[model samples]
Target: MAAPALSPLARIAREQDPDRFLCALFAPAERREALFALIAYNAELARARAMASRPMAALIRLQWWRDTVAEAAARPPPRHEVAGPLAMAIRAGALDPADLAAMADAREAETEELPFPTREGFHAYLRGTAGRFAIAAGRLLGAPAEALPGLEARGVAYGAAGVLRAAPALARQGRCLLPADLLAAHGLSAEAAARDPGAPAWRALARDLLDGGGLAAPPAGRLPAAWIAAALPAVLARRDARRLRRSGLAAPPRPGRPLADRLAVTWAALRRRA
Candidate 1:
């Protein structure tokens, strides 16, 4: 059953994700196409199961995504699907197959309760899970592979910061992404956060995360120096917006960032890679 779910991996491989494909287009056309499929498959996996239900079920489902990656590769990467893009990325850059698999692991962490002993622990998770992903993107854009470790540090910080900023809204899914200890330190319970919209600790946490992320610099590198730069500011702005919402005690919008504006921004950024 799991092996077959991989079919979407193939289908998604062929179909283009506007943001990723467009970003890739900014680089060498030969280079961009290779990574688009890899990114698309990961996106598909996230879409396949939007939120958590049971940890056991979520873990099993995550395994399926991992298997899908394997199954897709069992045969030659499809003509235009994720496999081919990944194949190209591997040839042109320093991406590791297992690094992509790490994303699935990160998703699994969300399935169960997230408990970071300290903020540092949370940062570590962000780097391994999200930082590496940014590095993979950077690699496709012609950044040096050796630079990934430091760059990963910065990318993960941004990711953790984003998640922290969004903590209030994300709790709606009945899971908390921030460290439970941090919330407890502020005298809030995860249960209270999910149920109590007025929780001060939630806002405080969001403020800290946004400030932390906003003050942090994007790593000095060829990747963000090029196309990733276009994307980074927007990511920061989003973190800022979420921080504002949390601080203002405003509820998350029933509908998020308007699509038209988003499309415009995404397209414009991709076109301006430098």
Candidate 2:
């Protein structure tokens, strides 16, 4: 038989945010659409800065999403492909408006086009963006309250790895997400790193961040199977970190091998560990 058609949000999730899309497939059937809607919503926010004509325009786009989430509880969301289903997820109490708003709020930093001021600031950005998303997904998947800490830790690690992976692209855009202080400590500046992402210094810097960025796996037993599914991006993060360690930041980041990702995610899910 031919495959069934994807919903609009599902198509967006699969195309733009494949890692989360893969993980969402492990969610219960009844909750999968809501998960896809949430991932599509995030993908939209992530692209807002790049899609805009200027920084101000990017901020305006983010504000529109923030307003949409804030008003979703009281009125119908704008007739947007992602927004409509996201609002439905919120209304059904499967997604949290506050968390969605925080995720959007975190992206506001991208409008500045500068490196993060401090390591704490960088981690905070990760916590607010990816961390919040994981928590929301876990809640939708019925993760217990106790799973929150592990979920947040793993999410932050995934965010850190993602920043490293996107370094080259961000450089091309005249932006750098690495902490300014750390860059300076390695005798590199944001402008310099942005100009030469392959500098040997960047390799050292990438290692420092990977070692200290809390990419360590969380305790195995703390999360349930559903929570593991929600935090599967962490598994990918670990794999990326390993590759970065082996090849250094001088190498361009490559797309994850689909079969390998599937096998790893499937193993993690079946083992009930992230």
Candidate 3:
């Protein structure tokens, strides 16, 4: 007989985005599954809030996710289908409840209009959210907490780069992910920043933020190395940003990396985890 149907939560964890699911490769056994599920829940909640719908049900569901994650229980058979993997992982080892709460808090902030006034503000948001989670993941992999700040830095940098890489799509959502004031302080508007990011003023802002990301890099050869692997995408985005003058606000298209290749990366990472 066939196995029971996957719950809505499990579907979010396993079937939402194949690319995101594939990122589980970077973590060890317990944390990898747990992280995937955590991110899945987050993505589902974020998607729900992106509000492609006019119905009240969507808002109600969003509120439920907000409440559940914001108040995750200490003991559980697993709260929801989405949080179950994390629950199991937390039980196994090193899933600090604070780390989970921190992430939820960040997402809650994201649901509101952003209030970043400077590049520093952008960095703070990135670090508080993604950087913190990456640090916790590094810790779960047995890296010390002191080592986390470095990894956290890389995570914040990467989060910024990811936004830049997805700038076009983000703009489509009516969100300008770039810290515009960094550009505006030098007399650039959002339109100007996006139209020709290679302009001296635009490039200056990019250069500053790009350089700031260097502060976030991990210690050389620390803990399985793959934990720092997300750095590659950020590095690529920075290099491309230098040439972004002609492109303006347009984000580069997703690179054509194949599934088989990603699977190979996953296999290698898992082997290290083992």
Candidate 4:
């Protein structure tokens, strides 16, 4: 017999945000829908800039999400596919409205299409966006308060790798995420880096970012299996970092093999590490 069809939110997550979707599958069955809802909502926020033709339009869309999150706290969210499920997730205590709002606010930087002025600013962006998302996911999986720090560290590392992986696309969009200070140190400008992402200067900068964003693996027995599952995407992030190190930032990321990804996550989960 064939498998049942995925829910609308699940479909969105599986297609648009496969890494988080895969991690969500490791969550308890009862919590999977709520996790999917969060992933779908995040996917929507991540694409808001791309969906809008103008910077103001993208900010407007982000504002709508910020409003929706606030509204979800009091009553039903706006009627929409992802919004309704996200509000449900929020109401069910599976997600945090504050985290959702912060995620939306983080994307507001993207609309400006400006390179980060400093390394600290870049990492701050990762913390507010990916770090917060990881914390929210960990909480959903019943992770303890003590585990939040580890999750945030791993998530920031994952976010750094993600920026590297997204370099090619961002370049095509005429945006550069490389820190301005680093670019200047390497005798390159943001426009130059964006135009030639394959340049050796960019590769060196990629290495610098990766080195600074190293994953902090938790000690064995420090976390439960559920917490490990929540941070499993850090495994993939490490893998992608290795690939970029080998091939340079200019190389388009190869699609991850599903079997390999599942095995990696399973192994990490079994070891109770991220």
Q: Model-by-model lDDT, in order?
A: 0.55, 0.81, 0.54, 0.78
- The sequence of per-residue lDDT tens digits that candidate 1 reaches over residues 77-145 is 547445466554554444556777787777665555665666666666676565766676666566665
For every model shown, what is its TM-score relative to the native structure? 0.67, 0.92, 0.68, 0.90
Report the Cα lDDT for candidate 4: 0.78
Better of 1 and 2 by lDDT: 2
TM-score of model 2 (CA atoms) = 0.92
Q: Which candidate is the best by lDDT?
A: 2
> In the order shown, what is each candidate's alpha-carbon RMSD?
6.9, 2.0, 5.5, 2.4
Model 3: what TM-score? Answer: 0.68
Candidate 2 CA-lDDT value: 0.81
Task: Order the candidate numbers by TM-score, best to worst.
Answer: 2, 4, 3, 1
lDDT of 1 at 71: 52
Clashes (backbone N, CA, C under 3 Å), per candidate, total 3, 0, 6, 0
Better of 3 and 4 by lDDT: 4
RMSD score of candidate 4 (Å) = 2.4
Which candidate ranks first by TM-score, i.e. highest? 2
